[model samples]
Structures are given as structure tokens and as C-alpha cells.
Target: MTTMKVTERVQGMGGPGRGGPFGSSMVGQKSMTFGPSAKRLFARLAPERVKVLAVLALAVASVALMSIAPKLLGTATDLIFEGLFGKQLPAGVSKEEAVERLRAAGDDRVADMLSSMNVLPGQGVDFGAVGTVLTVVLVLYVGSAVLGLTQGLLLNGVVQRTMLRMRAEVEDKIHRLPLSYFDKQPRGELLSRVTNDIDNVSQVLQQTMSQLLTSLLTVVGVLAMMFWISPALALIAIVTIPLTIAVTGAIMKRSQKQFIAQWRATGKLNAHVEEAFTGHALTKVFGRRREVERQFADQNEELFKAGFGAQFASGLIMPTMMFLGNLTYVVIAVVGGLRVASGTMSLGDVQAFIQYSRQFTQPLTQVASMVNLLQSGVASAERVFELLDASEEPADAPGSAASVSRGRVEFSHVSFRYEPEKPLIEDLSLVAEPGQTVAIVGPTGAGKTTLVNLIMRFYDLDSGHITLDGVDVSSMPRRSLRGQVGMVLQDTWLFHGTIRDNIAYGRPTASEEEILAAARATFVDRFVHSLPDGYDTVIDEEGSNVSAGEKQLITIARAFLSNPALLILDEATSSVDTRTELLVQQAMAALRSDRTSFVIAHRLSTIRDADLILVMEDGRIVEQGSHHGLLAAGGAYAALYQAQFAGPVVEEESLV
Candidate 1:
């Protein structure tokens, strides 16, 4: 049940029209058990293991250097204080005058600390030593910054290359997936996995991976310094750690669920927008524009609520951490001041402890703040990996290859269904003699297309076998089988390319003469000559720039270029006008003259000349003969033809 919900939500992301970047939903997704998925992601980074390890080493070195600086600065402070009162002071100076002078020159706290130390009169300050310590401190900070920059540059290449490889894997996965998988998924949602989800993973790796490592190192290094200076003060700072954890854990618990809801809502909204935009004309024509808008508004409002809850919860982490940190700092100061006054700790030691306290807690707070980013990255990775792990089309058997020397196709007792319990095609048997024009006519849902799909091996049968030239088609590789068959679907598909390129799509090695000849044979040359660029004219997406008839002609030309031994025409001429349809039919008749062909048509008049007409009803052939022979029998085909040619009443009278 959980898997189903996750799959549905992920598959439903990025509604039809209002697509967006993954960041829009990042704050709203719930944290999940990304342990396995995250491990997989790290495995992807393994190829760049050397660079990654180098970056980690730099981060550790940088943190160690920076951590030591505060301690070094403290030593300088102790040296300067020693210069002030180390058995050497101004001549004839009373104790009160020295204390007042120290106060005027520096902090009162430092003055009191200095006054406690005995000083000899006429001692001068060592300004040169102070200058040396300050210069070393500057050098350490500069070196740390340089290491950070070098790590950043190397990390950028590692991240981009990893993401590139991941995207390539996903593209390959798409090709291996079954057509049925796509049939159950939305195109927009799948596109989101490839585009938005992969991009989010990239962002997280680029932005967070280094910070997470460096922050952790800083926290560890600073804590070591704190304990090394004064365990008592370090203990005081440690008290805030559990409290910070408890508070952040509680808040994240509340917000995590909201984030999940937020991302799911975003996906739903995107899916709706994608659907509405893709079918905008149909929606408007059906007066469904208002309904679509209402659905979108509802999904958007849900996202707003989820986003609000998530952001509000995560927003509380930083300020709460800061407040608790400040409170810890105050406690550390009071205790350290008492210890310093009693000479248990030096003024310089007290100052170093305070700095270390801030440094330790700062990285803790930063890591806490990164929880949302980490969660978003994991969620996106899970979505992408989920697609990669989906079921793929069954592989063809090894050494089962065969060649189609003849196009004699036959289906022997084929049985299949899209769903197991609901059978659509049952115990179907048929034959198409070599070079025969077999016309299959059926009403909607009568399995006309499904029959051809079986013959083309698009869907494997549950029982029996399909054969080409008396050999089982299952013995041949899919590519080899499809290579011998040419198809022109009712819905024409033309990519954004030149007219000549579109025609040569199936056979890229086709010569210019062959392409021009195919175009001429399909009557595509009629319109090609009228275009501004002629054969070089580029077609837009969906071929929207050209008329439907012209687009169909291009597809027909593509099929002609392939010149296969068998053809499947599914309502091939339905897009053309009467005159053009006649011309296309003539061309198809000539094309099928020597090749076995399957023509599925609704227009009874079109298939009257078929060598054999198979009239179908409810997934079975109710009658089979010539067009005249079926009419003479007065069965299902005769009734259908009569209803179309004569009035329904007259057809009923003739049937009775």
C-alpha cells in the first residue's frame, strides 16, 4: 500500500501545464527512509572517489588550521598581558595608577585580570612580538580560505560529471521499459524524474555535500580545542547539545509530514497543468476550462498549506538554536570569570574557551538547518532511482534469431488481455497469405488494432504463437521482426526536422534520389514544392505548422522509404480530404501490390476491394469473405454495410 501511494504520487508529479523546478516543492516534502537510495547515490560518486577523498582531506586540514588559530590568538593575548605587568611597569607608579591605566587602555575585565599578576616597575611592552603573532594569525586564515576554494573547484567537476552519468542511465532505462509501463504513467511525471528530479539532486550535491563535511569537521575540531582548554567550561557548552537536538527533532517531526504532503501536492498540481495545457483546445471546446481552473486552484491551495507548514517548522530551528547558544555562552562566561579571578584559568584561556564555544555550536546549528536540503535531495534521488528500477520489457531469447524471407503471417489461437481478469482478445485465430491485402473492420473496442499489435509483436500473446513465413515470430529478434514490417498509424508522428530528414528517419542511409522518389510516390512532393525551403523546410513539434493531411503524407513517405515486405495501415487516409484520400488509397494499393498488408478502416467503402474482408464483433470474426459475399450472407457485415448505405429502418427490414 505504501509503495502504491509513493508510486502514484511520484508518477503524478508535474501536472500538465504548470511545470516548475524541484525547489518549489523541496521545503514541502517529508523526510523518508533514504538510507538505501542515498547509498546508491554515493555509489554513483564512486568513480570520482579520488577527488571526493581529496576534498574531504582539504576540509579536515582547513578546519584543523582554523581551529588552532583561536588558541594561537589566545597565546598572543597572554603574551601581551605579560608585557603589561610581568615584573616590569612604569617608574613610580602606584598600584591604583597601574590598574587605572590598564583599565583605560583595554577592557576592565582584562585590567582586573592583569592587576592580579605582579609587575616590576619600568617594564616596557614587547610590541614586536604582538605584531608577529597577528601576522601568523592572518596567514592561517588566508591558507584556510585558499584550501576551501580549491576544494570547491574540484567538487564542481565531480558533481556535474556524476549527474551527467545519472541522466544517461535514466535515458537508457526509458528505452528498456515496456510500452505498458508508459501506458500507465503520465508523460509529464516521467519527464519530471529526468529533468526536475535529477536537477534537484545535482543542486544538493553541489551546495550541501561540501558544507556538510566541513561543518562536521569544524564541530569536531572546535570541541577538541574547547576540552583541551578547560573541560569544565566545555562541559557547560555540552549541555546545550542535547537540548538543541531535542528541539530540532521535535520540530522536524511535525514538519516532515507536511513536506511530504507539499511535494505530493506539487506533483498533482503539475500533472493537472500539463494535462490542461496539452489538451487546451479540447478542454475549451468541451467547456471544461472552468473545471480545469478549479482543479488547479484546489491543488495549488493544498501545496500552499503544505509549504507553509514545512517552512514554518524548519524556520524555527535557527532562532531557537541561536537563543540556546547565547544562553550557553552566558553561563560559560560567568563560570570562566570566577575561575579566572581565582587564578584557576588565565584571562587568555577564558577568551579562547568562549570563542571555541561559539565555533562548536555554530556548525551544529548549520547542520541542523541543512536537514531540509538533505531531505529534499534524498526525495529527488529516490524518485529518479524508482524510475530506473521499474520493470523492463522481457529480453529476447539468445540464439532465437530468424529471418522473414516471406511475409506469410498467421495467428494461431492467440489469447491475451491488458488486465488478467478482463479478457479482450480470446482464442483468436487468423491467417494472411503471403502478399495478401487483409482488411479488418470493427466498431470501437472490437480489438481491430490489438490484432495488428499482436502481429507486430508489440504485445506478446498469453497462449499460442504468431508466425511470419511459417516460422514462430518469437524466434526472431524484435528489431529484425519490426524491420520487415512498416507501419503508418492514424496519429501521425513527425519530429522537429527537415521534410527530407523526416522522410529518411526510418532509413538514415537512404540516398537523396530514393528520398525524393518516396516523397513523389506519396504525393508529399505536391506540398513540399510549395514551401519556402522546399525539402529543407523544418517541421515544428507535432507538425503543427503543416495541415493534418500534409503531416500524414510525410509519415506515408517515411514508410515508403523503408520499403518493408509487410505494412500495417491503421486509418492511414482518415486525415486526408476525399480527393486526396482517393489519391492516397491508389498509392497504398500500389504499395501493397507485392507485400502482405493489414488495413484497419471504419469506412466500409474503402476496404470493398480487399482480397479478404474480416468483419469483427466482440473480439471475434463474425463473417469473412469478399465485400459482395458478406452482403449476400446478410450477417454482421451485411447489416453494418446496409446501415451505412441505406437507412437503419431499411437495413432492419432487409435483415428481417
Candidate 2:
């Protein structure tokens, strides 16, 4: 496998293009409802259902424990208050007698306040009882903390595992998708779905899952406790809930659209940046830096507008919730105070009821605030789901295996098109006998590369059949067919690795001696010997440390190492200088011995010695013969040759 071939396999297909199958229209559309997306997201957690249930149970236990502590603290407050007030009463006097004595002295208000407290006439500050109540409250709080911590840890494990599986599925899906799918999609936008969107989903889950559950349970537990203390006060405290829901609902409706827009803008911005950076040198050469910058600014502005709108709208929830909560607090406080003065409720009960009211509003506030995160998460989830739901290529035929012996290939009335409306290659047929060299020459978009791509099965035919060794290529398992073919394209791709490692990439188990022999055969040994690290010289990510010709040589060396039965050279020597091109040609000549080869070349001189030379135009074979035979015939090949070497020739429409 050459480096370009490996890149093709990994990236699937398609380079930077206009619009993808998942186009801008899809991205720009508002996420009207997240119900289905949320359902699908939760379904991914089905494997972790037991852990999720445990988290819920822990949340319930923790909230229950914490809720009881406030009430117990209220009891402690009552004990201290009752004891302090009891000291003012006469010693050894019954509570009823003391109250009557106080009433007889025109102290009815004081007597009424005393009746509300569970006080002994002779006692002062019951320290032991207060200490016991304080100890139980402390234990409840500690237990709640421990449970919360345990649940947090468990939830993290569940999330990490879920994300791991999600990433793996995305990777597998990419490999299975057809090359045409990539043709419509931008690299940066696809990457955003894979990396940024999925990461956002994970973050949203981490931040909201446990907290939402705990808040909801706290609300339920606290509400029950409030009602248990005083039904009227409980009712008053819950009055704000409808208003809270209405406010949150209205804000979230607007913010959800903005969140969707924000992520879409993020994808577009990332796409622009990736495209700009990848072709930065070209942009500079063309002096289009200012244009690129202007485009970037436009996309950046779009992202900012969307992001600001989302955050600003969601930010309204908290302050609005706080205001409603304060209103409820004041109402409850006033009501509880009047009830206490009337001797209908004790001081302890009223204090506990007030604490429950705060607890109730707090969780409500939390649930309302988390709406932003939920919307963001669901928006990202929809993007990821779109990727996962993309159409995949047809599955390989069952029990399909190609057995190649002499490398005979035949294109029997083959027809193919990139788009249904545009016929690229139609009714194409050819045969390359075992060990024959066939050269394909054509203008751009004349189906030269497309011809070889069909043989490799990078694409499937629209009609007819391509057979290798008398077996239909479509019926063969793609891997089984691809394993026998070696490819070298004009555009060389070298990954970040040592020269030796790159040469041995196609066959990782190749011996060092085989690696050296392949490198030497490709004229790579001459260059390697001059470098400090020789065969171990590391290539940077961009392969910038090496010259363009050197990168091309390394890819040729990789093809040589693979020692394939069928060879493809797609303008493989286009990058080298004249002197180096001679060396590469000699190397390719040696490599082509006894192997069937397809060489697509723009340079006519390189294919003059080929057994068969085909001249293609408009996806059809205009001429085919030896160089001398075509030159003598004075046809399209002769015209192209004349234009290259002899002089300017009158160009016909077919030639153009």
C-alpha cells in the first residue's frame, strides 16, 4: 500500500467540496424538538442502566438524609429557645398555672407566645438534648455527602464507558460509509461532528445527569416535608412553581433554536479554518490572504451572534427564578409568623417549615438553570446522530473471495457516473492481458483516473461488470481484492514516521533487508545515506522536512515493498526533476517486470514504450495503438504528441 492509498482508506473519499449529503440546509434548520434526539441518547445508556438506577437510588437516599437534617436542626433550635424562656417562669409551677399567672397580669400576648413552645417552667437551656439532636443532624449530613460522592464516581464511570463506545461506533461507521458520502461533506464539518459535537455531548451528560436527578428528588422530598409541617405554608411555597415553569419554558423555547444555531456556526467556522490552513500556501501564492481573512471574520461573526444569543437568553432563567423564590420566601415567612403568634403552630414546626421552603425553591432554581446545558447537549446529539445515520456502502457478498493468479483484468461494457445527470464513463470496455503494460492518456476529466479507480473498486459500476481473474470485482470482498493491488499517485502522502517505517508501512512484518532492498531499488537509498539518521530520519506531520521529489520517492519505495501482482502508477513521476525522473522511470521499469500494470501519464515520453497506449476523451476511447502506429495514423495521440514536442497544432473540439 502506498501512503496515498492508506490516506484514501482512512479518510474514505472526497476532498474539500461545496456541499455534502448533510448540507447547510440541514445545519441551518432549527431543532424544533429534542424529544427524539434525547430518546436516542438515553438509549445509548441502556447498557449502563443498572448503574443509572443506582445513581438515582443514591440521589434519593442522599436527598432524604439531607432533608431530615434541616428538620432536626430546627428541633435543636426549639430546645435552646424553650429552655431560655422557661427560666423566666416560676420554679416548680405547672405550665398551665404560669400561663394563667402571666395572663392575670395583663400579659396575654406573652402567655400566648409561651403556649407555642414545648417548655418546662423550671428548666433553662437543655444542653444534653440539643447536643443529641446536633449529633444526629451531623451524621445525616455526613451520610448524605458520602452517598453523593459515591454516586458521582459511579456516574463518571458510566459516562466514560458510554463515550468510549460512541467513539468506536463513529469510527466504524466512517469506514463503512461509501466514498460518495464524503464527496458531499467537508472535512472540518465531519471532524466537528466526530470530535467537538461528541465531546460536547459527553460534557453535557457529565454536568447535568447527577445534578438534575438530585435536584428533582430534593424538590420532591422537601415538598413532602414542608406539607408535613404545615399544609397551608407548603401550598404557599409551591405557588411559585407554575410561574417558574412558565418562565423557564418560554426562555428555553427561544434558547434552544439559538443553541442549535451556535453549534452549526461552530461547525462552519471550523470548516473555514481547516480549509484556510490546509491551503495556506496556495492562498499566499494567489495573494488571497485578505479574502481568506474576510471569510474567516464573517464566519467568526456568525458564531459570536449565535453563541451570544444562546447564552444571554438562558442566563435570564436564574435571576427570574431567584426573584420568584424570594417572593415565595417572604410570603411563607409572613404566614408562618402569624400562625406562630396565634398558637396554632409551634416555633419548631414553623422554623422547619421555613427551611423546607428554601430547599424547595433551591432545587427548582437548579432545574431551571440546567436548561441551557440540556439544550446544548441535545443539539450536539442531533448532529452526531446525523453522522451515525448516514447511508453506508453495500455489504460485501457472502463468501466472496477473489483468487488472483496471472492478474488478468477485463472491463466488460462498464459504465459509471459520479452523478446520475452527468455521464462520466459510459460503455467503457478494455482488457489487460497478464503481465502487459497499458498506458492511459487523456485530458482532465476524460475518465483516465476514473478508469483505474474502477479497477481498484474505489467505486462501483453503474452498469456491466469489472472482472479480475474471471471473477466479478463487485462480488469479491473489497479487502481481498485490494490486497493484491499496489497504487502510487502523483499526490504523495507521507505520515509522521521514520523513512524505513514509511517504506515498510504496506507490509509491517517486512524484514529490514527487504526494506533496504526496496528503498535502494527506488533510488531512496542515495538520499537516505546523506541524512544524519539515514533510514531512521523522521518525517514531520506535513512531510516538510523532505523535498517534494523525496516524498514522491518514498511513496514509490512503499509500493515496491508491497510487491503487488498488479501495479498502478497515476502520474507517479510528475513531481521529480528531469534527472531524478530518469532514475524513477528505471526503478518503475524494474518494478513492473512480469506484473500487469496500468500507468496514467500526462508526459507522453514516459509511456512511448508501452505495449498498448489508449487516448481517451469525454469518457470514451478515441484512439488506441502503439506510439509509432498512432503517430503514423495522425490522430488524437499524434495531435497531443505534436502539441507537446513538434509545434502548435490546430486544436479540434474533440482534442480540447
Which candidate tops TM-score? Answer: 2
* Count of backbone collisions within predicted model 1: 24
lDDT of 1 at 229: 93
lDDT of 1 at 551: 94
Measured with C-alpha atoms, the lDDT of residue 152 in candidate 2 is 99
**Per-residue lDDT of 261 in model 2:** 91
lDDT of 2 by residue, 233-306 (tens): 88888888889888998998899889999999998877777777888788878888888888778888999999
The most accurate candidate by lDDT is: 2
Instruction: Supply the global lDDT for candidate 1.
Output: 0.79
- lDDT of model number 2: 0.85
**Model 2: ten consecutive residues of lowest lDDT:** 1-10
lDDT of 1 by residue, 1-656 (tens): 00000001111123222333221222122334655667888799999999999999888888988999998888778777766665455688766687788778866765676666544455655678778988998999999999988989989999999999999999999988866676565665667778878898899888888888888999889989999999888888889889988998887777766666665665666665666787888776888777777777877898899888888887788888988889988999899989887657887788888899889888878878887776667767877877887888778766656766668988887777766656666676778888889998877667787778877777788887889989887777788888888999888899999999999996899999999999988999998889999999999986877999999998998998998888999989889888988888888888888889999998887788898998877556777889999889999998888767887778788899
